[model samples]
Each structure stands twice: as structure tokens, then as C-alpha cells.
Target: MSGGENSSRLIDVVLDESIGRSTPDVEHERAVAIFDLIEENAFHPVGDEGGGPYRLNLSLADSRLVLKVTREDGGDVVTHILSLTPFRRIVKDYFLICESYYQAIRSATPSQIEAIDMGRRGLHNEGSQTLMDRLSGKIEVDFDTARRLFTLVCVLHWRG
Candidate 1:
């Protein structure tokens, strides 16, 4: 397909309901910043096996992001951005998604990480399930990948 066709195809993927969760205009801006943060954070490749030249393509709306994981031979894995909730939530969700996908790719996957300590434990309860648990059946996310992501989370700061 041509660029125009691909562009149209991308446009068809609706943003996840997370964007609608933003309560205020300021929250909306924070969501955008979180998206940018995720985009920037995504530049680094994850896991040794499926080494990417991971490429990110932002969708039609600023609400979602598409990360295309590429191989040395030019093969690729296309991941659609499903959600971008308000404030700190998006940051949590994005990294969890990436880390979980990364971990799912591993030969040995960790069980799950849950949120405790009033969300201060740094564990992100993005959805009802851990990104690993959800993506585990779909992909393979191992320790190193998860660790890298956890580390990424430590460094990810939302700018107002």
C-alpha cells in the first residue's frame, strides 16, 4: 500500500477510552506529554532475542502511538497504541505495556506484578491484569525486559 493508504489504515485504529478519562484541559496536555515521554522512552530497543530497531509511528490523533519492532533483516512487529490516559496513569501504562510485551518474548516469564502500598510501590496497575499476564499468552516478556522497563519507569517524569 502507498503512504496515503497506510496513513488511512492507521487512522482507522481508534484511540482507547483512556483519552476520554482526562478530566480537564490541563490533564489533556499532561496526557500529550506522557505520550511524548513514551515515544521518547520507546527509542531504546528491548530484549536480546527480538532486537529491534524499534520504530515508533504516532497515529492520526495525538492520543495513540504505534511502535514497530524491526529486525536486522527488515522484518517488523507492529504494535498499535491502544490507550493514553491522563496524568501519571499513561506513563505507568505505557511502560507496563512495553515491558510486558518484552517479557512475554522470553523463554522464562515472571508471574505478575501488582499494585500495592496505595500506588506508591511503583508498580503500575494499568489494566486489571499485569502487562506480562495479558501479553504473556500473546508474546514473551522475560526478567531483563521487565527490569529495563521498571528502570525506564524510574526515569520517566511527566513535565507539566
Candidate 2:
């Protein structure tokens, strides 16, 4: 897959997790935030009319992430989440972060790329073969790397 495609896939997995078993603490407000935003089917004009279709409700202690779903032709629907790393571990009194990391095989910054380029060393691991195979050798995987990637798959498959 292309870089943008991979990035979006990663984001989807994270957002799917947030929709279901969302760290418990942040789930409630995140749900409520979505509710308020879509209080009516006629919900129109974003953010009190000044900005776009989204606005921060500071009194409500909001986050910029907006999760939306819509059905075209009243058929099967899908979720649309807007964020730059938007999902959080919790959104209780204060928003807590969801931590995720990746080691790129390419296009990573020069200084850091070399370290990851060497890949996970010390008899520890390499990347995942499944992804690599699917990518026609463009991607790679070692057992440890597959284990790391399982988190992404698990989150995407989770249901509330």
C-alpha cells in the first residue's frame, strides 16, 4: 500500500478501538461530544457558524476530534473520524493520550531511520512477514513485529 493508505489504515484501527472499548475513562465524554454535535438530523452549520462543520465546546471541555457516520441511500453505513491522532485513552476530567509507536522501514528521518533500518536487533526481532508478503516484499515482518502489529488488528476488530 502507499504511505497515505497505510497511515489511514493505522488511524482506522485506532479509531475503531476508541469506538468500542475506549480506555473506559475517555469514552463517556467522547460519546456525549458526538451526541451534542449531532443532536438533530438537521445538525447544520459547524461551530456556531464561524468556522467549519466542527467547533470546540470549551465549556464542555471538548477535543477537536469529531466522529461521524452517515448512510447514503439509507444502506450500509460506515464511520468517518476526523483527527490528527484524535483518539485518546480517556476523556474524563482531562483527556489522556493513547500511545502508539511505529518504526518505519523507509522514509523515516535520516538520523532515526538508520536505527530502525537496522531493525529490532539483539536477538529480539524483525518486522512481520504477513504484511511483507501481502506487499510483495515491499513490507516485512518478524515474529516480534507481528506481535506488535496484532495490537492494531485487535483494536480494529473490537466491538463495544
Q: Count clashes in each candidate, considering only residues at least 3 apart in sequence or on different chains.
A: 10, 9
lDDT: worst 10-residue window of model 1: 5-14
Please list the C-alpha lDDT of all candidates, in the order they appear.
0.38, 0.29
Question: TM-scores for all candidates?
Answer: 0.33, 0.22
Q: Which stretches of candidate 2 lie above 4 Å from their native place?
A: 1-20, 40-69, 76-160
lDDT for each residue of candidate 1 in 1-160, tens digit (9 for 90 to 100): 3332222111111223432333464455444544443333323333334444333332324643234444434455545343333324646555556455555556333443232222333444333234334334333434444333333232323222
Tens-place lDDT per residue, model 2, 1-160, is: 3342222111111233333455554555345434432332121122122212222221101222232322222221232222222123212101111111143323457757555434333111212233223323222233433334323332322232
Model 2: colliding residue pairs: 26-90, 26-91, 127-141, 127-142, 128-140, 128-141, 128-142, 129-141, 132-139
Per-residue lDDT, model 1, residue 20, is: 34
| Best by the TM-score measure | 1
